[model samples]
Target: MSAHPTRTDTLVIGGGVIGTSIACHLAEAGVGTVLLERGTIGSGSSAATAGVVRTYFPGSPLTGSLAVRSLAAYHSFADRTGTPLGLERVGFLVLFTEERQVEDFRREHAAQRAARVKVELVTAAEAARLNPLLDERSVLAAAWSPEAYACDPAAIVRGYAAAAQEAGAVLLTDTPVTGIDPDGRVRTPTGDILAESVVCAAGPWSTAVAALGDVHLPVSADPIELLLTDPPDTPPATLPMTLHADSGLRIRAWRDRVLVGMGRPGPDESRQAWLGRLSRLLGTVYPALDGIRVHRGWSGALEASPDGGALIGRHPSRPFFYAAGFSGQGLCQAPAAGEIVRDLLAGKQPWTDPAGLSADRFPAVAPSLR
Candidate 1:
């Protein structure tokens, strides 16, 4: 690739939410770093997200705590970063369409509570009161968590990037990174960079990046689509974000539009998935939003894992490290994941959970597949 393009103490790939956040913390820690992006920073899935920051994740105590701590970190970032992180104190609603799922929702709520997350179950009447448009007959019950939240993902990532730059970290946009070798050497479209370490925060492209080390991460490039509506935006009558209490649908009213997402989509799903389901949901859940014209439609690919967890630990085989497989939760988790990455790069003790995120927890998908 051109010998060595540039050199730094740390080389961070991708420049999206995870990368910028990691770069910020590393620079703050006095780790001379260079962040390379194939495109504009924060212009990928991070920009296309609904930005929900929830602590009600079902399992793994470390992740739950990591999310909680990340939320706290966002609060501080919003204050100084001026990104208007939109840290709405919205609670979360697990809306159920089926009777059996209500029981499951309660069980999940119980599990969440046991993990120390502030959550509970609510009846149809209570949920309807929370958002009058809800169909009491269709939605059997819900799990509510008042402390859960949302934010502006783009702003947050830009804030982290700005902070990183201010702290002496260098970021290169439109610089496609081609490969890397052990001991932190990176090859980009423009040149190569030598550093003490490489943090592969390439998001959906993580598997491709990790392959240079012969490491196979169980991450797939999955697409997500969300829609926005015209403004004169009014507060969404206290509707916390809703995950399909029954189906894969995850609905949240952000700005003036009802943002919709499905936990999983069909193999051949398209961008139309967002509009198609959202129209039906607006009619079923809240007839009031039925006629709201769609103003914008967008889609992005995320690096997802089978277990729906993140990979945030140091590499077992090389000086390469990672913060990948956020599935869809990287927005809130990035701050804490960044802090953990900084600690790992510095050879200091990790202050956050590394158990569920280590490469050891997930066997590398076969090398050929990678």
Candidate 2:
């Protein structure tokens, strides 16, 4: 071990969008911050994200509120960060094929309206008019949010990393954290970093990172798969990001190609089987895409919580913080998460009610490493 250890006011343990955003926020607030990443920035789950930006979570009002705030931040991301974020405000749609699903969404729509989210319940015909690529024959109703958007996840991470560096946050890539002590000493192959506070934002690997400190976070890394296909002829003027409620299929126009994402695969399912299921669902949902050639397909692990909401808050017994368990909403909720972590570290009131996102909601399943 080196005789002298590097020190910082705060140490962030991930280089994905979430960690970068937090580092940016901390540095912009004049805090001395150091961020360590196992690989290049955004190389983890953030790289493979769909980058759908919207404020339309039905069951979780906390997620909806966080997304609303995050959307505003993303709108002015480039302007504030002085880095370009390839943002496309193409709107979003949620298609429902069953009466029960419609009923649930109608309640959610009412709740969203009360929260000042600009959304409306529209018929299948109205939804089809908004997105001509969609087949309304089986879709009974839809929830439309015209203010939603899609952007480059990689760019968002890069933007935040640049802004963080500009604000004096030290970023080190290819530096994997091997172990973490309860007193904010992070062990790495290069050296040890003694920080006043530590933040574990390692996305899918967050669970293991926390375990190193004798913390048990009820977060799991689940597989999420996506496919890219050639755009159909006569694509709609505005290609809204669409989600099929019955099938859990997500589709959006990414540049000139159509990006399709499948639902979370079961534990025992194989990748090929999952892809086959997605293919069949795509054909049934959109017959026009029957012969579309798939350009590429890939899978990534998503950090998921039991309730499918984010876990953001401080540790109960230590000077540590975490922002994980975003399920698949990490990309859209990153900005707000940064602010929330910043406030928690500073002992200030967060802009949003973070009680619902506290990691303490989950009981520790293992004995402490101490």
Best by lDDT: 2
Task: Return the TM-score for candidate 1, rounded to 2 decimals.
Answer: 0.87
Q: Which stretches of candidate 1 lie over 4 Å from their true place?
A: 1-5, 59-62, 79-84, 98-111, 229-236, 263-265, 268-278, 289-296, 364-370
**Model 1: per-residue Cα lDDT over 1-370, one tens digit each:** 1123478988888889899999999898888888888889898778778778887764444566778888878878867565667678777777767767766656566555555677677888888876665777767777677777777777888899988888988989888777777656777767778887888898998888888756677789976666665542354655677776555566677655666666445668654784576667666776666666765567889778778888777765557788899887888688889988988887788875466677667545433322
Model 2 residue 297 CA deviation in Å:
3.2
Model 2: residues with Cα > 4 Å off, grouped in runs: 1-5, 363-370
What lDDT is reached at residue 145 by model 1?
Answer: 70
lDDT of 1: 0.75
- Scored by Cα lDDT, where does model 2 land? 0.84
Pairs that clash in candidate 1: 5-192, 95-245
In order, what lDDT does every prediction score? 0.75, 0.84
- Give the per-residue lDDT of model 2 (tens digit) for 1-370: 1133399999999999899999999999999999999999999999877777788876776788888889889989989888777677888898989899888877677668766677788999998888777778968999888878777788899899999989989999888999888678999998899999999999999989988877777789887778898877766567788888877888888767788987666689886787677877787777777667764567788889888999998776678899988998898889999999999999999987778788666556323312
